[model samples]
Target: MSHNAASEPDHHPVSTAENWWVFRGPADLPPPPSWRGIAGPAGTPVAQEYLLSPEDVAVVNTALHLRRPLLVTGRPGTGKSSLAHAVAKDLGLGEVLRWPVNSRSTLEDALCRYDAVGRLREVSLERERRSPRGASGRLRYRSRGRHSDIGDFLRLGPLGTALAARDRPRVLLIDELDKADIDLPNDLLVVLEEAQFEIPELARLPEDQQNVEVLVTGSRERVPVSRGTVTCDNFPVVVMTSNGERDFPPAFLRRCVRLDLQDPGEEKLRDIVRLHLGDDALAEAEDLVQDFLQRAATQTLATDQLLAAVHLRITGADLSRDQLINTVMRRLDEAFPA
Candidate 1:
């Protein structure tokens, strides 16, 4: 379905069938909404509830319906990264494939990593080995495996692995997209549009020899490839996050469904506190929550600060410790200095 910025969510899961999509690894499915655990971070054993506002739910559902990457922008620690984890958990999509962006991150780095030195070393060792001589000057040698196979030296990165996963539509978190260089967003346009990528090493081989079986980042088994091309049978649910650090190119923005997360209110804060801690801790942190709300009015604060403070209090740490609470409550805007 075609989607515009104003598109509404359908409010349905990606697929209805429980096992509609399967993966090789252990699945991290959250408890039903009626149960205790609706959402939190992924891979947690206990079920904890994470309440999503209707607007939040709409944006997520809209992204799913549109099949476009969700570009999430917000202040630091506003659950931007956690959104991807929540989607994966709720949808039974298995572990999230995360590519944390930095100032030096490149598009190729996220697609695949080739160990050329390792491959060269293996080739050198193979050439140096001599066959043992049998009786009557006959040489006995074991057959070498496909020593020239480029797949041996190639491992798909998280983004590429998510694209290559055939069983299910994996959740790919391109966290902190603004941390990347200016060219990064434009560079992603092609891959995002094509839903496939070519490996130069594999692509350079003769057409007949281009087919190889390769291992991906998150899978135990190898997948078949042709001409070193990795195509997506099920396009991954991509969630790209930014801290409102930089302006993206118009073309890049045009391709994504954007959402700007707002600061959490007292009720949501209480829910988040309860999710991490328990009912008793939630009650104890009420005063702290009010203080947080008052401070958040003029300064930037992350949800994690509240969580940290509550955790410390529950663990019997002295809240009166000098600079302890201050350290936890430090604002990102202050640290980065605009």
Candidate 2:
């Protein structure tokens, strides 16, 4: 079914069995309504809630023992990224520190970013707000050697935050490393091996101002920095994901534990469906699962596409199940008629 405009959402939890082919749009747009493919619940499962294969479990444990990044390579929808969350959940680590890599990503950007311009502007404004000019037409701050703390201008990125001293290890997810600039993987070798990074701004601070509280990327919480350097008390568990976009340098590959995710089988797919949708929907939806498996043999179809198709199926769709499957399972290159 074709919808005129996206319908508004309700606050209640999405029931596995929502009535579909029913109107959700404006009063003018009635009956045989479009599918609500985008209407899933808001948040994803945490680390503890995720499912991991035994092979994946073995490789992840190896990386944990060796203290190396686990590099995950897979096709789209193969759970390459979710592996990080599963590991964090299983280990009871706090929120995963995620660094999403792209073409512009760099090692320095990952470690820390100092906003000098923003700092200069704020400092100038702060001086005026705090104290008025004296007879010499110069501002006089109250008993000041350094007017504002340098730590205020500095913030650590995800990598840097993971490296900061903490009671326990943080789980760091470096997502899509293959999408990063060519040198990024190689540049990561030192940080991965050393588990430490220095903030030059804090490093050069006067001895008296050496210890400062600074901001980190994800938590946005300030942590104490000593002598401008950060060293992990516990080495972080690192997971890096890739879509098989490109090859990594041999030296870079040598340092990382690799895990390659394959598409889930029929049994695993049914289990996944049961986990996400519900047992109520699984019986009828299993029919689509077989259809999806058939198409997946000839063309690439992500697990998510199957989920979306199933999500619509469980809803009381006016359209026949076969029609809905044919419409939703189109190849990536297949185009819909205008």
Candidate 3:
């Protein structure tokens, strides 16, 4: 049954001003300048170098020197998460092993995941492939209970992969730890100090099968795990970001080096602008940057908001200041000043 074109409903009549959308059907835009879209030839994030304050640099270095996790706390868009990317990129560490935390996230989930059901299914299939049941003595004799390879059913997560990397330290970004369960921070203390984790699935294997090769999160290649234990030769650079939403346990906080990313100053803001938007956009950006700075003082505003407005303005969007305010430069709290 063929349907007429008019039979289908329109999606809000294609908007009153189609050109208002930067994501229209014909005018697809690339990713934002501040974003890293994909992996490069070197198998790392496509991020450019980012600036950090002198104090932040010192604190990061202290964490590296002490072989402790760097706990970065700050407001939104203050570069807490960006610090991990910058460190990983500048240090020639391969792709960062990022563990995005949430209220339901578990330590086991970040370490590794085992597909028990998949392994069981594989074993059942193997059993089915045996000679037909009750046909002959051979049929019944061939059906001994045997399991599939456990390695095929297990994959190491980001945290596990970082601890397993032996050549050099990989950067482990534990983003938004404040959103994690209250117990999570304390749970991480032992792992951060030990730099190793044991996989009980592999541990319970036969004495002869002490070692297994398993897949890791970001790579297809399997890494050899001896005695079911993955230990790092060098401590990984662990960076945990918090948005000042919660306080961690004293024990957890004691093991970490703390760094607070303050709001970028005028000089730092200009550098960030130049780095992301480039020199071509800089000439027309000063006034807008000034406007953003002034507004930031009065209300909660992020640096990205300024970048967005500047991006639209320089693109010849013909938007008025009032329009920009109502749309792009709205306060992070979603309200205008009194």
| Top of the candidates by lDDT | 3
Query: TM-score ranking from best to worst?
Result: 3, 2, 1
lDDT ranking from best to worst? 3, 1, 2
lDDT: the better of candidates 1 and 3? 3
User: For residues 59-145, could you state the per-residue lDDT of candidate 3 as single tens digits?
Assistant: 888998998999999888887877888888778786778999999999999888999999999878776666476435455545465
* Whole-model lDDT values for every prediction: 0.75, 0.74, 0.78
Q: Where does the lowest 10-residue lDDT sum fall in candidate 1?
A: 1-10
Give the Å shift of residue 164 in candidate 2: 0.8
Residue-by-residue lDDT tens digits, candidate 2, 122-227: 7877766667775578877654445666777888998998888488888889999899888788878788787788888888878788899999875558889888
TM-score of every candidate: 0.79, 0.80, 0.84
Model 2 per-residue lDDT at 248: 94
Please give the distance, in angstroms, between residue 270's alpha carbon in candidate 2 and its true position after superposition: 1.5
Candidate 1 per-residue C-alpha lDDT over 64-182 given as tens digits, one digit per residue, 9 for 90 to 100:
99999999998887778878877887788977889999998989989988999988997766654444654556776855665556687788888888888898899999999998999
